[model samples]
Target: MDALGIAVIVAVLVVATTIGLWHRRTDGMIRDEAADKKRRAAILAAAGVETVEFPDRKSSNAVASAAAKAASGAAAAAVHGNDTVRAANAAARSAAAGVPAAPDLPADSGIAVPVDSGVPAPAGPVDEAASAEPAGADPQLAEPGVPGVREPGDVAAERKSGVVPDSREEPGVVEAAARDASAAGESLDQGLLDRLGIGPAQATLLQFSSAFCAPCRAVRRISGEVAELLPGVQHVEVDAESHLAEVRELNIWRTPTLLILDAGGQVVKRATGVPSKPQLIAALGDVLPDA
Candidate 1:
């Protein structure tokens, strides 16, 4: 062929190659971005705070239909003397009613069932204090040594001065009263955790983070490492945006807010910024066993 024709053909080949390379590079970048997003989603799920997408009407209807079918099957089997099916039916009904289901005791289980009452007898000792408390009176507010309430020291001084004190006020008791107040607070915290579906751990380090916060990533790493080093310690990272209610309840006004919970799920300590590894370990020491 002619020299000019050969040169023109060569230029066309170079242009085509350049366009193909650019297209492939763009495709690779898109794939990489998608993969990174999926990896982050998996990490958040592992941290016990998953990003949930709102289901469309079709998907919601399908899920509801499936649940209804399962419930129907369980109810049908329950009529056939199947204990498991009976338990499932009860649980489904309770879930529909938005209440906790009663525990399903096996027929041969040694636990005694009260006659004339379909419920089992109480397994533990009754709380005398709860029984004695007057109706509509908050046990927590009634307790001494609590803020805005009568302090134990004041009660003692009043008793020594021959002033008649309230029956709930335990005069001459300070340390025990303080301990009781602390215990009451711990009990309330534990109950809150239970309602949130958080099980007991030796220590739970809850890190609240935002999507655009860079320091939050560092705190997550540090908290995860600390949890691994300490047995029975759990590390949970919550997305502050997704859990705004929890953020407001816990008074979290910043990203990378760390809440260190004791075994009883009580907030033992809290830090706002990124805490160093050593500082975190020191805080954990207070809640760790034998510390």
Candidate 2:
């Protein structure tokens, strides 16, 4: 072959290698987008604001929101000084301003005050319930300094989970699938299951497979074995090429995509590519009674 043909072959080889590496890098990743969406909605509700659904996981708006929340929490935590530090600072300022620091009083010191103020004291026993909180107002906010109530800084921190400044690892499917069942939003209806030839099943392991894919065979076996092991769980496989409409509607981007559905057909978990036996079992933990 001529040098030109040789160069062409080398370029094709490099391109193929790059594509294969990219595909291998992203294989077998399961996403828990439903839980992420619920968390974001709660944050918006707490702030008394609403935003359009996030375009995608990596959209600029989503990234900005996460960064802003993280920064706000770190700032709050840094500034919320301890009680001892605050007290010491108050005493130092009082000394500088020539104001006397108030004496610390014991908690059990029974003292009586003369009704010297213009306002008269209560005649009967003061109603603790009445003074506990204002009508229709939040008790915590009304008396933020009260001992048992969390301060605003702590509350803000609690709302946001820890944020890693820079991390590229994907979340584990098992960990994500363990979330509340309500967060699993995607579901297949009974009519659709009947059409797919899947009979009554407590949990369905629906897999989308393609003919040319080798990994699909392994996934088929794994899913079938799992279904047999777990009662009330049935394995159903679909040909992606033939079911074009279903693939498009379900957003099945790749072959061997597994969907774990509950008794009511809600998709509790999803994983793409070949999965291990333990991973599949863990993904089905929330849906199965004894798992």
Candidate 3:
């Protein structure tokens, strides 16, 4: 072969090798990116959040509509269940009061007495000795289904049907249940604050943020501004990713979650989104000293 032909053949071979290497590198980069995304999704899932792809417009609208309908149906079912329970309780009370099952009284307001078929009234006037004796009374005539008296079976039935019977113990049960509900609904107590290493302040704002969350930045800014405006108000920001244990303990499921703590470090208010300045100020006022 000629010299020029040999040089051209070598150039061709080099170009082919370069192209193959570039293709392999591109494929590896694509694989690595996919693996990284999968890892991130897995981490989010472990933290009680599922990563979702952006849906098309139509699918998004349909999903929103379905969610709204589901919510409405759930609310309606709750209302219906409450109403049914109330009606059952009212019926049970009415039955216990002898309001509906009581027999009609005599029109003349006279005592009702049952006469024996074969017995007749004495025609002659009663003697002094016989008149002095008291007349015999029938047990049934003395009481006509005494009001507010319930049988054991009836009480059990009412209870099984979700009607709380009127008894001395009922008030205590209701009070205890209310106390439990109040306690459950309340925010972190002093002991929990101490365990979390949160110090005492007049008002404290805790912000939970994730690394890739844009709204978290806005929340941080707002909380900082509020803290600067109010004296003795401290703002604490926590990385939701790094502090997984604390996030789980606080039940923080989303980024930019704000918890407003009172003087005793008890949570007074909480918000999930970027709250307005006025709203935050008002919430701080409620927990701040001398507000």
Winning model by lDDT: 2
Per-residue lDDT of model 1, residues 33-136, tens digit only: 11233455569979999675322122222222222222222222222222322234333343444322212211111011101112322323122322222110
Q: Give me the candidate number with maximum TM-score.
A: 2
Query: What digit string (tens of lDDT, one per residue) describes model 3 on residues 144-207?
Result: 1222222344334433443221222333212121111101112354445555567756667888
Backbone clash pairs for candidate 1 read none
Model 1, position 119: C-alpha lDDT score: 31
Q: Please list the C-alpha lDDT of all candidates, in the order they appear.
A: 0.45, 0.47, 0.44
List candidate 3 segments past 4 Å from native. Answer: 1-197
Looking at model 1, report the run of 10 residues with the lowest lDDT sum: 108-117
Ranking by TM-score: 2, 1, 3
Per-residue accuracy of model 2 over 1-291 as CA lDDT, tens digit each: 699999999999999999999878766655453443455566987999875532222223222222222222222212221122222232233234432221221111100000111132242312331222111011111100112112345334433433221112322221122212222344454456666667656678889999899999999999999988888789999988988877775668988898776654446567789888887877766566453
Q: Which segments of candidate 2 are over 4 A away from where they belong?
A: 1-10, 33-182
